[model samples]
Target: MANISMTETVLQCHPMSEKGFVDAIAVHVDRAEGGRLQIKYTLHGLVDGIDFPEVAQPKRTDELWKDTCFELFCGRADDRSYVEFNFAPSGQWAAYAFTGYREGMTELACAPPQIKCTAGEGIFEMTVTVDLPESLRALDVMAGFSAVIADKHGRTAYWALAHPPGKADFHHKDCFALQLEARSAA
Candidate 1:
């Protein structure tokens, strides 16, 4: 028997002294039966004043980080291996694997994830579901959820689970604040 031990969590943006265009960003993560991880991100505030990209295909795209996009960094503490996932409101997505700190970049082979995005009344929402990698299917994992938001004023801000004491580096170790426990065998 397989066990389902997934919980939905709403994540908050890393606090900073200075405020940006977005008043709030909500990132939610949960695991579904059959080894899938669902991630939803909602941007609330003056969305009309934000500069969001305009793409409609859910196909893989490069350089999405240059604009407004939500991202998740996942890895296990036991090893330096990790994966970076990028989801755009324009329905674009990408996944990359790293052997170590920015070394050996490989485009991960993955099925097209389900994604949806909508915006109205100062709110923008995006949802995506990706299959858990074979390596992480039955092990504890930590993840860092972040977003790059651009404002109508041409200013961009970085949001994450935790921002280290220097520049806004989403890959920093401290950013991995959320943890998911492994499922037990039945």
Candidate 2:
């Protein structure tokens, strides 16, 4: 198993003036044997100023990124194909398979992820766990963690482990910076 915790994420620049509503974003990743992955996203700052989606029945959904959402991306080191997962605070989620960087995208059919969200004084958090698609289960993997944060004031900020120059492109190859070795058979 491999465990990783990200240092504070970098907030991408936006056209609107920033109020610094959110102070920090941190992501913790745990990759277990047999393709089980768990991720925890923690946001520290003024929780009331951040807008989160309303809770709904947990199901597969699209466009979760339009609000406050946590995302995960992973792929086999030897293949161009990759997978992206979006986890909304509302318990809805989305998964997609991509042939390459921003190429060929289709909804990925898999077991629904287990998502848990909590809010408290000055902090917000979401935890999600899912099984990796069968194709990616036995290979070395590269992964990226990111989030889309929307303030109640209609302003949004992009947060990622690393950002490509110019704009916030989570699909860029550079964002896949973490390396995880394949788990060997017992």
Candidate 3:
């Protein structure tokens, strides 16, 4: 078993028809104990603003936009925790979770602390890193998990290389790297 921690920046594009973007800073810690994995997440950001739609209709642009953001975090399993939040809209928070097993775990799975957001411009950033279990190395597991999450989420998941480890001032600007991390017991 291995324990890992990672910091990732999450960016979600607003509905093509809508304006503004949703950005979040997420921090995650994962501890692999036996067959079950324990994870924790913390997220904070604005839900609606001048860039986002704000109307009072069920299917209006504003409602649709916000709905899209929330639906992104809706998980299909019982052992996951999903949280949707916004700085506006009464300052209240909504949360849901899957507290059990999630089917189909052949090789990879979506890392916990999945994020959803609206659309906008500018460089948004989040950092997710992990404390690896003694038996596993950080490089291999982190890279694999990150690729799997990006594949499953598609455009909803966006990542860019801020800084490559050990390469002084050399970065991959054109390539965006979105990653998810998961583990299995040995």
Model 2 C-alpha lDDT per residue in residues 1-186, reported as the tens digit of each score = 343323333333333425487777777766666777777888888899899999999999999998989898989767788999999999999999999888999999899999998899999988888888998877778888888889998978887777777678888877777776666544
| Cα displacement (Å) at residue 128, model 3 | 15
| lDDT scores of the candidates, listed in order | 0.79, 0.81, 0.26
How far does residue 99 in candidate 1 sit from its true spot (Å)? Answer: 0.6
Better of 1 and 3 by lDDT: 1
- The stretch of ten residues in a row with the least summed lDDT in candidate 3 is 143-152
Which parts of model 3 are misplaced by more than 4 Å? 14-17, 21-181, 184-186
Candidate 2, residue 104: the lDDT equals 97
Question: CA RMSD for every model?
Answer: 2.3, 3.1, 13.5
Model 1 C-alpha lDDT per residue in residues 53-118, reported as the tens digit of each score: 887867999889998899988899877888888888888989988897678889988877788888
Give per-residue lDDT, candidate 1, residue 63: 88
